[model samples]
Target: MSTLRTLFLSPRVTATGHALADAARRRGARVETLREWRVPEQQRRAEGSSLYAGPLFADAVARELGLGLLEAPQDWLARLPRELTLRDVEFGTIAEAWRLRRPAFVKPPNDKSFPARVYPDGSGLPGPDAVDGTEPVLVSDIVTFAVEFRLFLLNGEVRTASRYATRGALDVAPLERDPRRAEVLAFAERLAGTGLPSAVVVDVGLVDDAGWAVVEANAAWASGHYACDADAALDVVLHAARPEGEFGAADRRFLRPAPEVVRD
Candidate 1:
């Protein structure tokens, strides 16, 4: 069997990134780093243990490296507690949402293809030429979150979590025993049973008016750890993203599962 090799394409790994790499190394995986977006043919042929890329180049790099980065399901938020309030605008039908006119929060369902924010209306968005009509976008009713947390999940479990923000400020406090923690864990449990991706980042928040609600689900490989336990987060990242696989369409209700293993 070939030894596992982890690759990262970042000029400088952040503290969290370094921690993850260190964790992988501790687990006996050889870690490699490249400053370029493109992986050489020889490097790509090695036994890949894991891969992480910068946000700006993540999607493109993943495609070139054939990494499997699981994304959030389109209708996942609707299946959670805040479904009644959150809305979805399909790629080709966003004009209808714009017709609604009422103020609402808008963002791409998976990728950061476009900015996620409150748009006054369809007119507020960039012209049609700038927005891809094939990518689905989420337009939700605006709500206030008193606290927000990011949970790294694998095999229907919360491996590690962190309180990244409180109220509106950018905070990085460690998670503690609180009602919010319990609430988000329960939410994750329910989401796991719903046939979500094998590994993922489930973001939950304490809404000032709506109690605990889901904020969004992001790909673990591309998400920031904030104050999360580096070792634990690394575990989730390992399974969540891979060097190559063909996704199964029926594994998750909406989200796809990674392909079968590819050994060197």
Candidate 2:
């Protein structure tokens, strides 16, 4: 049997990473850890069933390790309900964003290059001194939601889901059957039919007055599981960024490794 290899960034290994490592082991996968960003040149190339890394290192690892990190297409936004999506514009400079005539929410689409917040207008945003005005900034119309949920999807199937927040507060609730479940599922199903990535995280929220709407789409590899099932979430994670038909014998490094030796 071939080995199912999974690599993670050792430096940024969080509780979520640990949980995934454990779950992968249970599924007969071999898990490997590395400092993805600064991998020694000699060790740059590796073979594995799957790989997960921070956005900064993900591309590099995927290239060198021969893994595929699934992702939504660039124009996926066009496939969503235009009414639910906030009007967004990409600016190369805060000064360029400052030219907006109306209020909106602003953020970097994929990174923390700039703060994501509501601004009265372009001029109301932080100046160039706060962040790199030359970096790309996404300015979008402001929208609000009463309840927000995160769904882990795999090949059009909603494998696991959880209520992540309510009224902007950190509220972890299970996404069980309810009055809005059917409607929510319908929306997700619509998105699945789109050209969006087969495996990804879809954040949906209820605006009450506006009904259900899409909050955003996120790459499953870098998203948090929230209160979703770890085992089920792991299933999504495995396929979220894996090569085709690469399964093999289980690597037991994480299953039953040597005990850590601590010095007093």
Candidate 3:
């Protein structure tokens, strides 16, 4: 049974967000686009509500509604074995990354706190004046991906996937048309039930010279569907953001910390 009765969206809507909202409506669920950060009084009294928005907006609304948003641990990618990652990756502070003398790919683990890109050297990174040196970041050896696909995983299986990029450019296409479809599915199967939240997004790609490698994990509630089946993506989003009381023991460990709520 679906646990979603109402789907709340952030003030800013994207194409993917509209698709999800339409899908939710087709499934007999009411959808509402939030006018502001504050949850409306009617929604506050509604039952079985779930949210799909950016990390910051999702966190605030989820806190107000007592919902739990599931996401991979900040260092989940960094902890994966070399066989899966296919390159060296480390989780450390910006201050630590600033000491890198060689080129590397650096990004924040869960949010867009900083621009995620390759830096020629430490000097290319944001200085202490623009960002706090203590912020966490993922530093990885630079590599090129020929193509990248986004997999929306639910219950340890890939429910839907879409080719989201080609050679670092936005190129959305159905996964079924790709000749590498079988290979991508097979590689993703290896990561089934591998400690990620039951519903999450995982990006995998074919490196220029390497085989398949994981790009990163993202919270399903905040992920873009691209060409993925909107209905299937909606299913993942429902599971990714649900009432806190319904969380299972396994899912609890992957829950994102609740945001602090201030009341007048």
lDDT of 1: 0.67
Native-referenced Cα lDDT, model 3: 0.89
Query: lDDT: which candidate is best?
Result: 3
Please give, for residues 1-264, the per-residue lDDT of candidate 1 as tens digits: 123466564655677778788878887777777676556676663556466654555644555565666666765665554442233433334545556467777776666666788887767765567754445667777788888889988766888999888887887776764446677777666664664676788887877765666788888877888888888898777776665543455433333343333334
Q: Which stretches of candidate 3 lie over 4 Å from their true place?
A: 262-264
lDDT of 2 by residue, 1-264 (tens): 234555455467676787778888887766677753444555444545565555556644555554556655433553455654533434355668878788877765544455678877888776767865665566655667888889998878899888888899988866774456677777677665665565678888887676777776677777788778888887776666655334222211101111232333
- Cα lDDT over the full model 2: 0.64
Model 1: residues with Cα > 4 Å off, grouped in runs: 1-3, 54-56, 79-97, 177-179, 245-264
For all the candidates, what are their Cα RMSDs to the real structure? 4.8, 8.5, 1.5
Off by over 4 Å in 2: 1-3, 40-45, 83-96, 123-137, 177-179, 244-264
> Candidate 3, clashing residue pairs?
none
For model 2, state the Cα shift of residue 157 in Å.
1.6
* TM agreement with the true structure for every prediction: 0.81, 0.76, 0.95
Task: State in Å the error of residue 69, model 2.
Answer: 1.9
